[model samples]
Target chain A: MGQPLPAPDATDPRRAPDWVRLLEARATAHGARLAYRFLSSRGEVVDTLSFEALAARARAIASVLTAGGAAPGAPVLVVLPSGLDFIAAFFGCLYAGLIAVPVPPPRPHRPDHRMRKVAEDSGARVALTEARLVEQVQAVLPPGADVWTVDALPDAPEAAPRTPGPGAVAFLQYTSGSTSDPKGVAVTHGQLLANQAMLAEAFATGDPTSDGLTSKFRVVGWLPLHHDMGLIGNVLHPLYQGGECTLMAPETFLMRPLRWLEAIDRYRATTSGAPNFAYELCVERIPEAKRAGLDLSSWKVAFNGAEPVRAATLARFAAAFEPHGLPPRAMTPCYGLAEATLLVCAAEAVEVDPAGRVCCGRPPAGATVVVVDPETRRPRPDGEEGELWVHGPAVASGYHRAPDASAHTFGARLSDPDDARVFLRTGDLGYLDRGRVFVTGRLKDLMILGGQNYYPQDVEALTTQAHPGLTSGGAAAFAVDDPAGERAVVVAELHRRNTEDAAAARDAVISAVLEGLGLSLSEVVLIRQGTLPRTTSGKVRRSACREALLRGDLARLDGMTS
Target chain B: MTTPDGTPPEAHRRSSRASSAELRAIVKSRAQVEKFLRLGLAEALGISPDAVDPTRTFTTFGLDSIKAFALTGDLAEWLDRDLPATLFWDHPNIEALTGYVADVLGLAE
Candidate 1:
């Protein structure tokens, strides 16, 4: 198809490409075309930016950073709300040849230690944010890192643009890691563009020669700009295709699920996506009256990812919105992680395996997926479950500043004699069946709820700190799938077992988790001391504890409710 | 019925705080606000209204951030007022939230 799309090779001078160059060319080619539209909570267009305006603003912000003595390859933190300023600041960092780090703004009245930890880990000396969040971001950022309000910067049309090499770091994605140790995945320009190309090939959004197809590639979404799915999949993918993207705040969509569908209808968006929970929310919360007005026929790709894809959720969503012009083939279940730069595999339609796991489709062109035995580092045959290992140019080189962790995760060599490629250990367990990927479960002890990653150790530490009677290393936190969604359940061993003390301990654990982690526990089980299962080395076996809890094998403390 | 934590049930707490006639006379708006929050919280938790104790904190019923925000959004829609995003966090219990909401609506007794 039209020269078979060249592989993304940053070293090739003939095709040396980066997002900055791509955007600059697009600005010159069609400066007046719509780039992004920011929508208000009520679905009103509050802000609009064309390619020309976006390029100008990015240059203005870049000049400010460059004039302020920002060196090339330095990491700059972008802590702004979901709006035009966030997008401009991100491009501004790239324009200045600095690595952009996008993170969520701190919540009001809450001490954002996570943001502070990220700043400390990345060693970001300059932070860009909106005017209203200048003070908030300044309070959380490490001392000496200047916080500049992007809106206040003056436009500098003659600013000298800095062009970074393809191998240079483009951005630092800090989606993984715990609060105490935040790891920033260093994604190079080559890897970023390569992943974007893979996505285009998989979604068939390439080929700019087709004017009709290019115009029909409009994307509408409300995912947060900081997350990988939103940044890479929703934001960058549209730019790669030279298509328009309309965005609204995640809170706006969550407040009223109907607004998302209405936006799709209003914009006639060809692509949109959210996690499985969002689809479930639409089915549960949106009344019938709201559905009558939605016309989702324009939505060609409704991707569900960032968490486990439930067949039931997809079926329910399809059945509910079928009458409103939604085609059953529009649902796409995808699998990806920050380390992979965005997407790894995605299916065009919902195809559930006999085990009830939804298919995530085949690996895109130039990418390879192999299941491997986590213990032996040996590759598993097809239809066998094991840790998934990905090999391709789309996989990131490694985590920034952590060579040992990077080598362990990104330097795996397959045992097969014929295949000597380095594979990324995806910590996710799945199997390949008939050229399709069906994810079974996670091998790591991480819990994903509401599209947010929560480490078991973080939750356990918070739970133990909530009450003195609870043992420090005696708590096991894990996720259990329910019809509502994936929910966390904490089983803790308490020293004191009196009725009042047990009740107080349970309440304290719940409150601490909600306040500290912003998560709700489906159940707080107070077990007797020495009842929690542990390994020979005394580490808590979380999966065993989960199974025991599911089987009602854990001995409940006296006076504790089920 | 007294909860396991020895706290009185929702009905008992309501009656002890103010008689129905006195509450109606003092402020009819307070009851309306409380009923709205109670019903919204019940629906969010997938529990019956009778099982919801207003005196108990929102966290006691395991209200996560997403559910809290969703409930607050529904309350904002029902009241037709632009409530703060931290409405639930600032006033964690139903009684405190009702009081704050009533005060914000200028229905203080």
Candidate 2:
């Protein structure tokens, strides 16, 4: 049922070059059609917005923003919770030709360092949030930056949407970098549309003419709207296809994953997805008795991405939900990142490699994926593991305000003379088997747990600061497979080999991580002095340390063994 | 605080800031609440109910942030009321959490 997108026409303005124009066209054609439905945690629809109403709200917010001295192309932070207000504010930024920076709202009674880091890095002078959270958002924003409540904006007369050039930065997607330094990927309007179109083709979403089944291409998702997968894949994908999207807060799903399936069944969602942990959570938490009276037969595409796709997770999920009318073929394991503006490759069918890694399928049209040896910068043959280098329209322009990092990551050149194209060095190690991509491991030491990225250096820094026994710069943080999912393991060398000190240090490390980063360590191994693996330059080799920890080669302190 | 159909009780349906007296009247007995907490913690940590010692902190059983949040969510669902997101952090051990819950529901005798 999937088909390739039509060629771009530079002359035809009605074809919707950017998201602003796309929404304008949809407003004109499907003015009364339901665009979004925001649901409460109790499975009740709290708010609904039609295309026309959404356009009107966006225009009003845009007018207010412009009147408040927001210059076009300036970054505006959209720091609201998961609701229709967040969606309207995001579009309002585009309607005003401003770059939208979507960040998670600050938690209650917590010091929001991440929000402050994002606000500082994006250089956003204005933030848009709900009435209830205006004060909280304002507290974390830079001193001069102002916060406005989106819900209280007065209605304004409709104005024509601004059509910025396709190359103009539409939004800044801040990847989960370190707490001190967050990286915001500058995604242009052209790149966003290209990735959405590719998703439409790959998932076969919004195919109204395919059959009666394609008539209602709805999507139900509970992923956090601040993240790339939730914003691009769940929220925007439905609008791109002129279909309705039903959204709930991420906490709603995590609280009871059964609500996700119940909503999908109730809404007859044709396309929906989350990270692999969500599916595993459902299979683990949802009892068999709760599966009664649910009908997922109408569900078509269940895309899994944003983290490693485990063969065991997919198989277990399918086995658990198959009785509820979920087709085994609907389990789509895809791969993507924030730098790529969302999707890179997606498999149509569930396939596994000999190494138990799920096949991420081939790159979509208009995207070229090549596996290359990172050290030699030469292309690797099929079935050989190498870094995945991508060159495509979907790739973002670069990191905002980071020239060196942008050049190092986005301006990669292969050593092969035949291929002169510049590629985005995806720091992800994988191998291509006859054109299909299979991710083996991460070339970068980034740990992804619960669809959130955690840099090891950040974890190690927090671990070392927790106690005096933990030697400074002697901690190595890494992820290991657990029954629940990937869990963080902190291996630190103690300053002294005292058993009492080791126990105290372990407890201190766990509490510090939880209090500082709001994360829990699965295990904390305190090794003797100089037992950790380090390079000649004294840089900790996380992979080597992880191997040593797993193999029990490290001389762990007494009572610190797993 | 669940009805026969497992829906939240009337007191919990009002708001998150319900009066303690109203909650006390509608909530289950303290022993039943403790049993539920132990069972829920065991289910979340994937261990037997007996293994869930009331004296030990949740961190001792390797309950990470996500699992702790999920356990809180389940407890909220069972009691049919919204609890603080930092419920686990504020009440580190089962004994402390049970005491907090009892005080909130006015179960102190």
Using TM-score, give the best candidate's number: 1
- The deviation in Å at residue A125 for candidate 1 is 0.8
Q: Write model 1 residue lDDT over A1-562, tens digit each, in one string.
A: 0134544345322243677787787677668899899998878999998988888888889988887787899999899889988989999999999999998888776788878888878888898988888877777667766677897985444567787867889999888767657788999988999898778767766544565325457899888899998898888888777788999988888776777899999999988999899999899778675687788998878889999999999999999998899977889999998889889989966889887899999888889899999888897889999999999888998988889999999999877778779999999999998777899999888899888888999889999999888879989999998865788999999885443588789889998888777788878888988889999999999999999888878888764333
Query: Which pairs of residues clash in candidate 1, taking residues 3 or more apart in a chain or in different chains?
Result: none
The TM-score values for the models, in the order shown, are 0.91, 0.91
Number of the predicted model whose DockQ against the real structure is largest? 1
Task: Quote the positional error of residue A469 for candidate 1 in Å.
Answer: 0.8
In candidate 1 the C-alpha lDDT for residue A461 amounts to 94
DockQ of each: 0.30, 0.28
Cα lDDT tens digits, model 2, A7-58, are 4355322247788888877787678889899888777999999988998888
Displacement of residue A526 (Cα, Å) in model 2 is 0.8
The Cα RMSD of model 1 versus the native structure comes to: 5.9
- Each candidate: what lDDT? 0.82, 0.83
Please tell me how candidate 2 rates in CAPRI terms.
acceptable
Q: What is the lDDT of residue A288 in candidate 1?
A: 71
